[model samples]
Target: MVMWWLSSQPKGQRQVVVSILPSFICWHIWKARNKAVWEGISLSSGDICHGIIQDVVLAVSSEVNRWNLLPFFDQFFDRLSEPPMPLQCKIVRWRAAGTRIATLNTDGCSKGNPRASGGGGVLRDSEGRFLIGYSVCLGVSTSLLAEVLALLAGLRFCHQRGFTQVRVQSDSLVLVGILQCWFQCSWQIRREVFHIWQLAEDSGHFSHCFRETNTVADILANEGLLHPLVQMKIYNHPCMLPQLARGALRLDRSGFPSLQLLKRTPA
Candidate 1:
């Protein structure tokens, strides 16, 4: 019926008329399914086909009458009898082929080697838009676990938001190596770490960065150590670190071990 109506319409309008039927049928099926599922009713395949036919017939008849094109109805019906060769198609084309994706920075801080820990993540788009910031407290666990958790959360958040590519910056070289498949770690951390790595791989692209460049996430992780409700808020404020603040940031580099696991203040 839709093809018939389109054929009877002016040549210039045929494409526009034919293009609308696919969307209309898709919506019609969706609504029918919703009604059946939510309204405690069931429709058979025959019933669905009948409904579609009835709708198409009514629509075609109404349009013909409204446009005073009854004289062309036979030709329209003849056109409807033939299978439609769709000239328009909707394709899933990539809009951001070479465009860079948002960058995510993440870090973990533990008060003890296998005790109270905290993790945080920060996301910034290619245009430098602050997309999301999050921090969370982890129960008794290893620093490795905390690090892995931080990466997991960041990747999960990005995946949920449909981010195709990302650079995940972190302070843990061990974690980065593990993610890059350059090191052999424990089975426990390896399992979760592998999952996170796979998630990044399934997406378009991702990379790791050093802690020096991941200050925002580092601060958020440290702050999480002091507050449990920190994750509920989004930090949109500009991140800045003075000399002292930079010094205060803790991670095991060479001489400096993570302050969270240290027994006393550094001299």
Candidate 2:
């Protein structure tokens, strides 16, 4: 019935308008309806019509093959143009946790940002002796997703082992910010982040660290890429890790700090 109705409509611009109209119209209508109900906004017919047409034109015009197809396209493109920002580098140092507290450092590895991902974490005492560690293959995933999953696994380990007042650290600043409620989490990893929250409750303190300081966990994350899918391998001692990872663990145990060059953002 809908196809027949669309067929009867006048074909505009190689039938592209007709092809995109049905879905776009329905979508805009649903959005308008929600705005009216939830926000208590008065939706005038003219306003709704204008919005739908503007959105459709923008959507179509932005397509690579359809660039500047509409009169307003040039205006939209001009507004979006911006100059690239400059970057400066700064040094950051990693410090060990205070005595009597456990530290959990986690890292995520991915071949591509959204492909062939894995997560790993290491738990250590205040003296930096390895208590437990884990590495799990996540198949294909985004870097953020892998990070969130690794944090989740680490938190679960702490909770199950009756470890309290733990300090959680990760190389991903975004992941730490999400835990600190400084930013919203991506929808893809919202569930895992939420689970981490539940697991941590009041006992976990989350913080961001440089990747250089998280060497062992980073190595484990790379190792995760070779593990079986969804399978988590546990390490009770650093000897269970690869040679490079074991060496890094020893450095960490010695309280040796790692330095990182980080982008210095403008105030």
Candidate 3:
């Protein structure tokens, strides 16, 4: 139906290639809808667009032999494949449960496989105010290792500080699974993965969060790479404090949970 409507619009042949954007978007959305209804496969807009990009590329690859399609395809694919930026005014934020239980958000960053990396975590109280933040350089490793290290750092911080009740949140779904003992981990992450749950004890309840809500910690994780190879623990590092403050204020006003676990299944 979408293609039929587009065909009847008197678009030129050049427009034919560019027109794949809307047509593929609608096609993927429709495909996603049917999957949700019958196949029980859930897809986000990102997922749908990714599928569309792959399908469109495959479909257009055949046309390259007949037409000078490289330039158009390269530009279009680059624009489409770029990572989606987080919202500037995103309401999804860290919320405090009460004055007692601190909320922890952890994140990690890596340059490449077996490259320079860092892990960081932030602690906030019930009022959505920063309590503590820390960043540690991991020398060189994969991002997954850094992410696991971040969680370990957060959990260890809570335990060492004698914080009685805390909620731990991380954007790494795999890390959360390891914390829950969902499956066996590879040897590289196996040791620290066990260390996280052990350190959590009774005070910590780990949950998976979306990256949007975990922005502040992300800053610390990336910032670690720039800092001298030393761990720093403080509420507001001068360079990153302003951004964290703005993020906190937005979340506080929006009244989103300090740590919201994004659920996959329909509630």
TM-score (C-alpha, index-matched) for candidate 2? 0.62
Candidate 2 structure quality by residue, lDDT tens digits, 1-267: 486436754343325655766776788788889999999997887666666667766654534232333345335334334222344554444465667888889998778988998888888888788898889888888888888887887778778878856888898989888888889877887888888888777533888887788898999998898876547888887789878888998887776766555544534
Q: List the residue pairs that clash in candidate 2.
A: none
By lDDT, is 1 or 2 better?
Answer: 2
lDDT of each: 0.60, 0.75, 0.69
Order the candidate numbers by lDDT, best to worst. 2, 3, 1
Instruction: Name model 1 segments beyond 4 Å from true.
Output: 1-99, 202-208, 229-267
lDDT string for model 3 (156-209, tens) is 776677764688888888877777767568799988877776777742388887
User: Which 10-residue window in model 1 sums to the lowest lDDT?
Assistant: 89-98
Error of 3 at 136 (Å): 1.4
Per-model TM values vs. the true structure: 0.48, 0.62, 0.58
- The residue-by-residue lDDT of candidate 1 on 1-267, one tens digit each, is 655535655443244446555665676688779989899677776666555544555665533332232233245545554443333322221111123666777888888888888888777665544567767776667888998887787788777768747777666878777676667878888778777867887422434554545666777777667666454334443343323323433221112322122222223
- Model 3 residue 119 lDDT? 78
Q: What is the full ranking by TM-score, best candidate first?
A: 2, 3, 1
